[model samples]
Target: MRKREIVLRWHTIGLVRTGSTNYLIHLEAGNAFLEAANLSLSQKSKHDAATHYVNASLVFKKDDPKKSIQCLTKAIEIYTGKHISATSTLWIGPFLSITYTTLYTTKFSRVIFLVLHLEMGRFTIAAKHHMTIAEICEKDLVDIEQAIRHYEQAADYYKGEESSSSAMKCQLAVAQLASQLGQCDKAANLFEEAGKASMENNLLKYGAKGHLFKAAICHFCVDLINGQKALKTYEECYPMFADSRECALMKKLSEALEQENVEAFTTAVQEYDNITRLEPWITSLLLKLKKTISEEEDIT
Candidate 1:
């Protein structure tokens, strides 16, 4: 009877879809579940309590974030402690199973916690989330460093879920930010990674032109040898993209870069712009690369 009662309580706490309930009713249901789950403070019960608390917090997230934080903190405490062991975790089958809900619960809770911090104007909090968190980290807070971290986190998470396109976009964001930080090699690698992810997802734009083009440009920013090698490698990887206009532009730019001729590079860029405006980001990187080449010539 006690075990049956515990299972029922666990069901109540675990599957409470707060979005479907009235706010007050959800709160009441949550409190009741918390009470039942806490009746016995075994590891299973503590885990239930943590889950219950997270659901409870989700109810009051908009109006009472501080309360939500307190509840989430309790949840975090249970999950991070050494008590939830592997063997014992197996015994607590229903509680610690690797369901979609189970796997994402901790990650989602952290995202919510960080989102709450962003809402409260706490810009210094760890940047982490699905999508909104990355936007807030980069667009609102302007913390490029943290934004990059969160974007990478998001990419990894999406990759785990087999969300290839979504993962590609996150990788693209990380690559752009890495370029901005002047970590051009890192940016090039990330861009190549994004391109590969896109191709794996059958994303035509990125697979054929977008990411490979950007990767080559990132290499260009570093030096002519690396840049030409990157372009050659990109063409070899995507033979279909070898004849694309963007690739032609890259070839022309490479010649100009090799010659350290600013006029030729500028003319090539303007020629491309006259037909189809280069992405503003690409234009900016090109200008930066031009300046680097010019500076190297002056130094020599």
Candidate 2:
């Protein structure tokens, strides 16, 4: 009876091992089927094409333009019915157009046509086509001012669409460009408008930068005007700097105005003393002040 019990125990162990192996095999097959199903779905949705193009774009951004172009081409072909999504060609169309434009040479007909139109002074037409190109290229380009202008034109063209943000960005770009051109008044106005728009949009940084630019305009205007009002403007707009020459000059001017001492004021004038020296009108005023001070000293 003991021998029979030992044999039964061995048989039970063998049966348990077989069951464990079968269970593992079933799990492995299930995982394989799941992977195959995922691949089928990816192919059906043309998601693989999107993935390839997006990865290639990333590679291009990382400085491997040639490899990136190759990857993009493969992706374009994959999406264009070579391997996936044969019945539909939606996702790859815009991406291919963008890639083709990026890779276009001067010899390319479209680029040549664009150049000819631009050279012929067809600015409006050229701008329209350039906008198309920019839309395709999207974040692949920089030139903030150019992008802003393109978006502005696009917003105008698509008037029915909501483009308040685009308009505000365009205004900001215009303000920045005007500031660079030293058109302080126009820049200040645009900045103010941008600040208002940004505040409405809950864009804190944009509003702050706008206020900063407005302050800068005030500072520049004050320097040009040179009076008590200008002095007050400078004080109001004083930015954090290690040492600001403009602030120093303003302080010196204010001190000289307060002291009523001709020699001290003249000596305090640094490099900008020429401004006071060359101006006959300012020199006459200074002489009058000096004479008045001298008379006061004499009476004392």
Candidate 3:
């Protein structure tokens, strides 16, 4: 059993290194790992069986995210049964909503490692693995709120890494997604961090303007005074972008806000849509913002 297991693991790793681009190789790797898992089960080695399941799930992630999620759900479900805790359970929100490919396409290998450590009752190792899984899921999960939670967890984990700029991109991803979801306050804060991160890393100098712009827009969504201040700061940072269409779009919204013209704001959004279609989430957020602004106007 040991020899067979070693061979299967080597086959899986070798294939991943040399032939990951080939779908047939992934299929072969998956089959070999599945066989190894079955062998472990037959031998009544729960630990080894779980390991094989984790490996197989990683092998299948690229070609079959749906199956990967199933394997993850199985591993998580098993781990939950073994050790129940308030802290562990608190972080399992995204995992709880795991459906068979109807929801996410994240890498599940870290999640598998988390499960392995959890089963062994190693809280420290499990916590690190948990953060890694959260990062991966934050990049791929469809649910905005869940993704935000993952991003927050990931920033904490990633802050310790040598390259803080790379961590900033993770923050940027969360901020952009949050803005699209109308979580304006959180988005503004994240975008500010992204801007500062970029400024600190000369490599991201050109990208700072973009981050600040997004942050300013998120601030704009929350309140007019803060919005104008943020927009002015962004203007000071990237003066050349003053005449750009994106800048104009923000300006148009500001003008509408000053006039309290709901119809003009809606029309401006529609006009922007004519030039470039907004994402569904962005559309939803814009409509919500418009509704809120209109309601405020009705009060006085």
lDDT of each: 0.66, 0.42, 0.62
**Steric collisions counted per model:** 0, 0, 0
Off by over 4 Å in 3: 1-54, 59-143, 180-182, 199-203, 240-243, 271-279, 297-300
- For model 2, give the RMSD to the true fold: 22.0
TM-score of each: 0.60, 0.28, 0.56
Q: Which 10-residue span in candidate 2 carries the lowest summed lDDT? A: 90-99
Better candidate by lDDT, 1 or 3: 1
Best by lDDT: 1
Model 1 clashing residue pairs (backbone): none
What is the C-alpha lDDT profile of model 3 across 63-120, one tens digit per residue? Answer: 7755654554444434333444332331223224223242234478776555444444
lDDT value, residue 223 of candidate 1 = 83
Clashing pairs in 3: none
90-186: candidate 1 lDDT, tens digit per residue = 2133443333334335566765454334333211111122344456557656778877876886676566555666777788888898898888999
The best candidate in terms of TM-score: 1
Ranking by TM-score: 1, 3, 2
For model 2, how does the per-residue alpha-carbon lDDT over 1-300 read when each residue is reduced to its tens digit?
A: 453344334333433333333545433333332233234334453433334343333324334333333444444334333322223233322123223334343367775565434323322332333344343334444344554455455445333234466545545555554444455566556665554445455555334443433434333433334344544553554342103544454456456545655566565543545543434433343344345546656787
